[model samples]
Target: MVAILAADVAGYSRLMGSDEEGTLSHLKALRRTHVDPAITAHRGRIVKTTGDGMLVEFASAVDATRCAVKAQREMAERNADVPQGSRIEFRMGIHVGDIIIDDNDIFGDGVNIAARLEGIAEPGGVCISDDAYRQIRGKVDITFDDMGSQSLKNIAEPMRAWRSRIDTNSSTVESVRPTTETAPPLGLPDKPSIAVLPFQNMSGDPEQDYFADGMVEDIITALSQVKWFFVIARNSSFIYKGRPVNVKQVARDLGVRYVLEGSVRKAGGRVRITGQLIQAETGRHIWADRFDGELADVFNLQDQVTSSVVGAIEPSLREAEIARARCKPTERLDAYEWYLRALPHFYTLNRESLDKAIVLLGQAIAIDPHFALAKALAARCYAWRNPQGWATVPEEEKAIAVRLGREALQDGDHDPSVLWMVGFVMWQLRVDPEGALELYDRSLSLNANCAQALALRGWALATAGRLDEAVPALLQALRLSPFDPEAFFTMSALGCAYLMARRFDEAFKWTSRALRQRPTFAPALRFHAVCLVKLG
Candidate 1:
């Protein structure tokens, strides 16, 4: 018997646990509308249908994969009319191995291996074996990103696999390959690239927003005059106005090594300004200060902030830039809007926010088709929609995201925010974490203070088993965005890194702190539960 190719959905059984009838209705609907048709087109047969998933048999691995990818894309589109909470997502796995023909039922390592591979796939994603990839490469527009080899349960030999990125744009998906760099860092001597965000305007006058905003512009100008360090233009930094945000995200979006965020409060003709300097690479708050004087002294306040922020950021930045990178992408207004919309969505870090973000960012790209930020955000959002069960048709989202992310990079690979967003979605949702990690590092080198890049880099590092490096990076993210809700991810990541390092006490303590902020965090809750088990 020839090795059978198989794929199934992960967590389908549990998804049905809460709502069996509803999940079954969606499942059957998907099969009727998309899955059955694609399987027929590929000449594959449905071996059996589990309550929540399906076991399919194919003559060749290539046919199985082609059918799988096609089905995902179609189903994703079909599910668009459905609400996010009721979406049916599938994780697919393909492998070639002999199977026992048991009266309309298939059983053997072939079936089990495929199931394990499915476990590693992002929701609405496909993971294929070396044998499957060999048969499928160049046959379809799907490009495979190598995931090296993974150890599967009960399988003696490890399997080498590649993740498929279905390009919805150009229809030419090829194997993902590493790129070489040519541009040297802008080569700053003493200063560093920086962005100043709107400090909180505590005063009742909403007009003070402009005043707070002006302070940022002044600092950007002052830093620009430093005759060193590349300063992100004021237009880029001001995009963060009104929205509470992550400092790491600001750094990445603005392409700066350092970030200066503060607030202005004016009462009774007197004003107070508080500013903090952050090192984006380490997510560290390097310095902080508060200046007090009459509102007329605003000029002096700006001067003090500019000088202090410049002085504090430069040294930390230089130390990080010992290994630096070059920049790329949009100086256009359209791209900037895309970046703005994408930032809130991506950094908001939840299913509901991600969905809204996708819609808003798509609108941004509509304004500027060449906007790299919008493209990258679109790609990331698609990646989220599928696995997170945020939409009915998960694969549709993946295909679009894959295409948009690639286009965003092609438009400008040097944009730190774009690169980081793309990498994050690919790694977290596409099961291509290694690729995501590399992109995160590249983004940081281009702009050290990019808090989103740093947080993501730390996440990638932890996943890659580099907990030592992740610890400090997560800490820095917290320092930069002390007031932002995203501080939770950093605290949670800090706990995970500690757990990996076997610092159980630290892990428990840190996780406790994070839970204090968000008691219902699912992952944190699970991690804490495990830690308790270990301690017990």
Candidate 2:
């Protein structure tokens, strides 16, 4: 395996359009003075150059990472006083993997991943694969922020990414240790709010952890579908996993009025789930229940838990809402199990994991072809694969995605999760933006708190140049899921909306916030660059 680094000027096309000769001259000069020296010093070889971009090979990930950081720092200093619109900034991505060498050219998944990483990287910043990060963690003194699992275009499975932090004040990079300081407790939302902690696995077998975790995820999804409930996103709530938790403290931390804690035990084709809803402010047990059922009836038990919790929160909750929340994803237990198995892999966002997820979801669909949720998820995986450059046959995957998505819509019109997931696939795969918007509307009508649908709707609106409608939807998504891990996506969409509205200052501010949260987010990076040019 070898370390590969890919980098390109962030706005090279625009720069070239404005001043072709000047842009080329500046790029050459920067290479000679900063880029070339850094590469040579770090023992890296330039594989090729594509006008504004270059591919390099390094024997060591440490050398590649150090080289990238050094070059970015130099470029930052170089562009310190340049006109914002004229400044040239580079985005870099690094990955360590096996490569094929032919005719003095290097090619493979390694090169593709590195290039895709560069595509999503922040201008003037570096993004590295988890493999590279593992190699350079203690060897390099620079601090790195975990970017979680990122879906790179055309790359299979999701890969965890890390961003190197650059200290603008000092020549030497410094490590910033995570602090124990927590933000002031957030105020509860206007509506009823709750956080469901990960259910404890009491089955004695460590392998059953997925079973319990999936159960919690389903509960969270069910509660989120309740239009009047403000439920914390799974990512935020899962932070308290495998640890002791204080209900009141969790409420304060998450800004929720209620906290749900539970345990799941499975043995001998039988499962028992116990759940309790606590009023956070007063530390009172609003409701508590234990459900016992055959393993085949796990879905019913989950629905019971959800209905009990909702009823506890508001005893007068309408029966229609309860029935809607209790919609069964699939009647086949085996298919449900397969679907559950696919979820963890899906979240990993790496090529292998994503492929595995697709396989699992496929199995689920085969077992129950009418399983709308499974089909929707499978379509989503295909959609994700296409954008990340992971799909080997774009046309084939597109057709499959469209088919699965359409089938899901036909079968799951009343299922909010199905509507939103299919809508996302439709919007992302460019099947139909208007249709996607309508799907989002339908999803919100069923589950008003479907933040993902809201965010995607806002993104679609902004992309369609409907700034007026996009901003509020995006803002509402942020308001509903304040602690959502993907909130940066909504923030970036808002930036795009404001940018199209010719509100450059607001665009800059929102994009800046997004980059602060996820520096490698491509949409935000692109919008922020434009905002800089417009403001200048």
Candidate 3:
């Protein structure tokens, strides 16, 4: 008999997408520094290595459990200093059974069971089959929870499994952060941060759990595309699944400012998903909504929930940030601090505050040359300046803004905000309309929830005389971000698209709505005047 251990990185594809070179280097370092040594110490033999996974064989199940626990604990320690998005975490599973030893490699149901268990194990956790659990029952000084019978993929028959829980009191490093210590609260990120707790299945059918999980995963993926906020990865956030957790406690553990929790109910070919966003620090509910649809429209329901949640959170976060900025003195501000201070000013949409916003952004860029967000926002300021007749050298300012926009795109290719901002600059500067449309498409590809990109895409298309296509895109953008801070952009784009199609009344209505949001927005003002003239 052999104790087989199989392990793999969770969300390896996402990690690579965010930073490919860093992910490979970190994996190599982890294997060399922690994983290989732990296996050798437990007298475990590495049978084979797959790109993001490994299979090993050990003589004793207890030794295998010990090695897994030790390696997981060390991984948590190693990731303490790393950013949450870039951390390398693993899922491990073990099984002890008869195996065919072929040229130092093991095969058969034993190895298959191990791999299947690893697939279902939580990130940074370990799962073991009943046979392996029996061997390590009294020998290993660890606690295991019966996970019940799991129907694993490609495996015949269901297998009962147990998940190992890291001992809070005995762990060498803290696996779970404390929730209620009095002295110091967890530090918040520079921008809005959120954790989406896995949705509960209210239908009482265990099979419905997968559907609920899939919806939450899609929501998480959508939320991560928002470049202005920090979102916890699915692997880390799923740790709270099926557990009774307090929002405040989750915030502290995850170091996030906000928490989103929800439930899913499916019955009689209808589905309902309800979600609420809470300000974790204050324990106050910021936004809540519910969506109901037919089972066939499940994806559309998910899109609605995701869009509504994102739309509500954006204004709430902006208001909170403005309030926070007002409380802090601007004299001691760093790059991030300066960026925060500039936001309230930028939102004023006036001459004096907009000028101050530009100056603060310049200071922020001076402190951190590679601050892509700051650079992008500064480029936006210049774009705003030239059109408002505030630029002393309009042509020169446009050229400089385009250069900064390009630099920001190069530095933040994977970031949605940078992509959108560069596209916005390209369109406003009249640099290249086709290139601007491509950037908008790329931005939306990264984050479908980016209403700003969709709106710009509509505008670009409308200007290129594609009014039929532009109207629907603009309308969709409006639906996605109804109360967006820059709702004027979407509304005006819709008006322009309508005007091109010679829909006078519809153009007038949208232009009026745009004027309500920002009377001074020149494009909207111009569109509104023309619509009225056309009506008269």
Candidate 4:
């Protein structure tokens, strides 16, 4: 593990466009006199530099924070007399985490988090991850303001951040506000909405531009197919192509809640595609990832990237929307907001949370009788309650569950989520395994990357004595969503599939893993006990 520091000019493109020669000259002068000297004094190593940014490595977080603070102080002095538009201000982010060293350069979450933190930093300021903050807190004399938990793009979980409070006596940090001259911000659509910007061709091969552009188009098309999303059209998003953009501004202009941006790089026999999704309103990263494959399978690579991106962002956006709903006044929530509010409770997998989820979903359905997703989720909740011994009226719940499941299929058979959820309800209630299988298969046909559907299908197949097909389906679901909240359920299902196939050792392995995630999961415990008895 090492401390990584990422820094970039606030408006590099605009500065270069205004006066290319002068900007280049000034940047070189600043590096020579201020930035480089500060890094050297603090014992930081310059790992790499781009046209307008640099990545630095340090043995300690103290050194990295000291170096960044010193450089910003010097820059503040240099730009004291410069006009706001022309000042060469810098934003810096620091993180201390494990890094993958390759060819004398570094790659990994350490580098990615630092870079994303830099993206959200105020100009002439520094942002550091909690890992770095813990290392340098009270160790360094500089003061830092807690920036709370931030959802950085690509990183799996939200991270707490700290921003160094630049001393007013030494440097003045100015807040840059958005211009009022542009058109008023567009209202966000009813459903979760997003815009996918064209991916950059980072391979430096002009010919590869087509490949990158095509991938973006394909991703946009795929995301649009997810009935829950209100995806911005291709032409609207493409207008920002080849331009440096502020993500928050783009969100306003496009009237979207989320924005997706990425780059494609091609090497000799391989290509790598990287993508990150960010919340437009708060400039927070929601998700980020990279996909790599052989050039021979470029089209397949495109499809893979699209499926993985769409699949990953769906849950992320849902969680983000749930958080948004939580912050709103309870009386002001609409039907969609009510549905969003129910999700966290449902995922808790406990009796009380499940009861609350049912109530919230009932409220949502009352507001909009045709809210098929709510009905489907409510049906699943009822189906789950009976198994957990939480249902006071089992027969009544069974009838309600069946009625709601049928109504959901009638209203939203086209939606993959609704289909898979209703399928689970039917299967859990022992309605018909074959019918449930058909619903699962149809859901997969709609969105092959739907991990929940794959997991449910695996469970249904295993219970129906189709072990061969069940095992692979469950494994694929795990791959698609390794960190999924419902992963324990999949792991448990895999245990059952293995147990049914008389693979006692594999059953023991998966059941043990599932128990680690959810110790009291009854199905996994039963499978684990059976596995131990069989192995004995």
Highest lDDT model number? 2
Against the unseen true structure, what C-alpha lDDT does each candidate score?
A: 0.67, 0.84, 0.76, 0.78
What 10-residue stretch in candidate 3 is worst by lDDT? 321-330
The TM-score leader among the candidates is 2
**lDDT for position 262 in model 1:** 72
RMSD of 2: 23.5
Stretches off by above 4 angstroms in model 4 are 1-333
User: Once superposed on the true structure, which residue ranges of model 2 sit more than 4 Å away at CA?
Assistant: 1-184, 318-323
Cα lDDT tens digits, model 2, 219-322, are: 98888877778888786787777765556567777788998987887766788798878787766557767898898889888888998998888878845557
Tens digit of per-residue lDDT, candidate 4, span 87-144: 7888999999999998989999999999999987767889999999999987765667
Residue 185 CA displacement from its true place in model 2, Å: 3.5
Once fitted onto the true fold, the runs of candidate 3 whose alpha carbons sit more than 4 angstroms away are 1-333
How many pairs of residues collide in each model? Answer: 17, 17, 0, 3
Choose 3 or 4, whichever is better by TM-score: 4
Residue-level error in angstroms, candidate 3, position 93: 41
